[model samples]
Target chain A: MKKFMNDPETFIEDSLKGFALAHADICDVTLNPSVVTRKSLRREKVGLVSGGGSGHEPMHSGFVGKGMLDAACPGQIFTSPTPDQMMEAARLVDTGAGVLFIVKNYSGDRMNFEMAAEMSENKVAMVVVDDDVAVEDSTHTTGRRGVAGTVIVEKLVGSLAESGANLEACVAFAERITGSIASMGVAFSSCTVPAAGRPTFQLADDEMEFGVGIHGEPGRRREKIAPTDEIVAMLLDSICEELKPSSGSEVLLLVNGLGSTPLSELYLVMNSASKWLNRREVAVARSLVGDYTTALEMAGISLTLCKLDEEMKIHWDAPVHTAALRW
Target chain B: MKKFMNDPETFIEDSLKGFALAHADICDVTLNPSVVTRKSLRREKVGLVSGGGSGHEPMHSGFVGKGMLDAACPGQIFTSPTPDQMMEAARLVDTGAGVLFIVKNYSGDRMNFEMAAEMSENKVAMVVVDDDVAVEDSTHTTGRRGVAGTVIVEKLVGSLAESGANLEACVAFAERITGSIASMGVAFSSCTVPAAGRPTFQLADDEMEFGVGIHGEPGRRREKIAPTDEIVAMLLDSICEELKPSSGSEVLLLVNGLGSTPLSELYLVMNSASKWLNRREVAVARSLVGDYTTALEMAGISLTLCKLDEEMKIHWDAPVHTAALRW
Candidate 1:
């Protein structure tokens, strides 16, 4: 509950100033309003811009560097960035090649990024990643949702663009990754945003909610504590059924820690995933076990798997340089 | 806190499986125990290996890819990888050029990595990074500690080695970056590792601690909550004085969240950091704002700064490919 800030209002602005000051090699900040973009002046490649509420570091902004996003419009903590900011980023990052907006499948993010993409003069391609496999849509809402799978789309499309692929190619690549990737998360405890000064949601000492969202959104089902293997099986079963990649198709597994799960726990979940997949004889080509994308200090882990072909593999291996992710 | 694991002992292995599956293109997992390595075989370049407990994801394993770590040894959750695992990793990653072990400044990590380095007959060099500015020698039971600053060392040295720097030169470069870098963190709450199933430490709602280590290790002092500026001031006063980089010296700043802190809170703190450094006229060459190194959803941010010269900047900008960090 303790936070360091002069005022909640100035938090985003001040943080952007410091972030801009430090990452001059790869990023620059826009004035008057506020936005982040790669330092490259040409903007010759198909510009890819992404943004959302600010709490997720490295996601919207940390991805702005070579082989990734051309720009990112960062918003207030857990709040959507203004549409105007996204438009400015679109203008700044657009090369003659055009621009693309990668968005998580959240109501606020979808609405904002989509609005910006439509309003901007630059030829814009918009892709919303909705790969969370945790939720089963009710008649009132969309099935599943976007969570950590957003990062996979960014990586896939960013690398394609960096390799001189055009906007169309980038869009196609983004779609492919989005289709293949699936994520499911569970939360042991709710995270309290500093300004909010309280837990987002309440959980008992011995309970956990399966399939939680990043913003502490409600998930499909709540369950009691279970063995890591059972949890992994539940998550993987949901994702595999959703993705349904052809048998023997290679897959990339991501065991993501919600904010609070320790790496050890993540590892335990991943071990279950490996055994489960091996038993099925599924070829897991690569594995990423860590906190790639996180839910604020929620003690849980999400499993994301992206089915891959040779092209995706090449894209995944391409060199990249960003503050949060570098490979 | 509820956790997802069949047994405490199986966490690391499962997680590595998920990790390997998620990044199949860039990494390969060995089943006969567990070790992850880059797919690109480099026979002539000196291989770099680092590993420790699983809780700190992307630290040792997530970093294994091009232009960074070549291989990572997996240990049980919150436990150091055995010397045998490290040796296996060293041997697997080594090319004719030699191998370098980048060990964080922790007793277990140092001892394990050192033993691996010594056990291997292949020419190997080792560099231990102890850049946490918070751990004053006076209070430490043993020696200086490593915190978030290890990321900078890993990236810089990884780039150098990838570019074919010799073992000694790589060690020297890592040493140089480690010497120039300093980091300090503050935590509002203690994190609960899943297996442990309890708070690492307890804090009153109104209390906070400065100089916290990443593993929920207690800092030197605890104090009542102060204004953001005052809190940041206390941190800077300790870290800046400890670093004491000359005025006008170029510095790279990293404002890192400890897992749970939202971007809004981090930004607020960074505003204070920017104003403080500007008041001192310290030249900031660059900065990185995000969760580069985190303590399993601890609700806080750490500030890291490194005095930078032309060489450091060159390496800083170099391309890298890894699971957690890319570019």
Candidate 2:
């Protein structure tokens, strides 16, 4: 493999070690190197926690800072963290205000986070997100899986928690925000796990994989590669159909790159998505375009649209200080 | 090639259209679409004008905000902007204070920017950056070509300009700071020019290129891919040997990813680079890790080290607002 790694089996541990060392100002590690906690915390505010597999950098770990995830427990690449990791992270962040876990909608994650909440002595709650309207079921997931909207959920709800919201209020906001969001992705090529040393899936040089999951799993369909506008139309059409926003309604838009896609391409996607929304008379309240939730070295882009209300808009505009998704 | 693009001939223009729409709050295109100027400007300060080829998003264009470049003139993909484009940008940003053109050391860019300075009426000075100690000459450049250190130049000098430095003062600091910087890069694959319809160069799956230029030009040598530490050793050693910072020196380190490289790998690069500097007893005053200067869709990383002084540190810590490289 041409990857910049020491060993396939030890990639996650080494990555986290380096991550903690590099971002010491904003984060620190606990007894378990896999669990990252914010360097500073508010005693009277609800504690926020989020995590998933290791390949998606800046997802859970990079988001652990002042205005985002309070603690993150990362697993191996494309694998869910164990309940023990979550339990330890829960204990680290549990002040008198209580703790909330932002869990994605995959079976392993769903089961393990549930186990952690049940097994922990602290009062724990989770808001499971399933905004990917791509497929109802997938290889590693049960119903519609969580995708890029997880970034939005963390950004919006994390800000609310920082505002000294109670645990119940944070949980309710997470659920409400996730319910109004829809995400879909397309991949030009698949990614390889460091241990596997080969791609998880393959696409011909001229073909594309539409509605791709974050783990390089099979999507809704594969099709011949098309122009930028047509490809954007297909993804936005699917999202717009599900969202059904009225002419005067406003929403927040996210155009995220899946690992290896260029920023230029992501900007193009935003440009196209904005034009489409304008033509449909749907006002876009705020827009974020960058690589937030990514598959390791996967070449693709994902789009997430969150139908917004006034509360979410104000929370979204609040100052967020994190390694990623900073304003 | 599997890229999200339409009409290769018009890709640059189309991409800029989208970029302007996406960042309308901070930037806009001048009458000449190739010139992107900050929406708000300080007329009394020296106007910083930077331009080069397109494809490297968030570099020239993304840096055009309150404390960075006053205007950025982007050429077609991997091609230098014409004298006319630079002249237009120079005219747009020029107030009572003169304009400073930060040019990378490519032949086309050097020639075109020189012509633009001569052909314009505004008081203009050009500072050429050749910090890439990779080779004395390359495909499109003369002397040591400019690489990621251009980002450092733009950031530090631009902030200085915002503090009301005159044209001569900005030019002197730009040259002094650029002189202390050194950079080197490695690429696993060559980037394709959209109009060319193929990668600029070829590499076997297990082989890698060291000292590769930002535009897919040949480097000092090609070798079989090795472990991350060994690869980093070669890059850092080469940079250290040329710049030669002493044991008690302070420096700002940058680990920049070529486009298409994952952030995880970039972080590892920073981790490795940091450790190497520590072993050498070199104190890193500041560090930045991400894709700042990129060959479109190339997989590799570059290492840049700038010997920092007290003035540079203070300017670096000053509040600067831009699309990329914000604190």
For each candidate in turn, give its C-alpha RMSD to the true structure in angstroms. Answer: 4.4, 1.3
DockQ of 1: 0.46
Q: What is the lDDT of residue A245 in candidate 1?
A: 66
- Candidate 1 per-residue lDDT, tens place, A50-142, comes to 888776665678788888888888777677888898899888877799998888777777788888878999899898888887765622236
Model 2: how far residue B9 lies from native, Å:
2.1
Per model, the share of native interface contacts recovered reads 0.70, 0.58
Candidate 2 - chain A - TM: 0.98
Highest-TM-score candidate = 2
Docking class of 1: acceptable
- TM-scores for all predictions: 0.82, 0.98
Report the TM-score of candidate 2, chain B only.
0.98
Give the Å shift of residue A86 in candidate 1: 3.9
Q: B1-327, model 2: which lDDT tens digit per residue?
A: 877787787677767877777678889875454799989888778989998998777778989987788999999888899999999888888988989999999999999999999999999999999999989988998798988999999989988999999999999999999989999999998888888889899999998999999988888899999988889899999999998999989999988989878787887777778888899999988888788888888999999999999999988777766777566
Give candidate 2's error at residue A115 in angstroms.
1.1
> What tens digits encode model 2's per-residue C-alpha lDDT throughout A101-185?
9998999999999999999998999999999988999998889999889988998999999989999999999999988999999
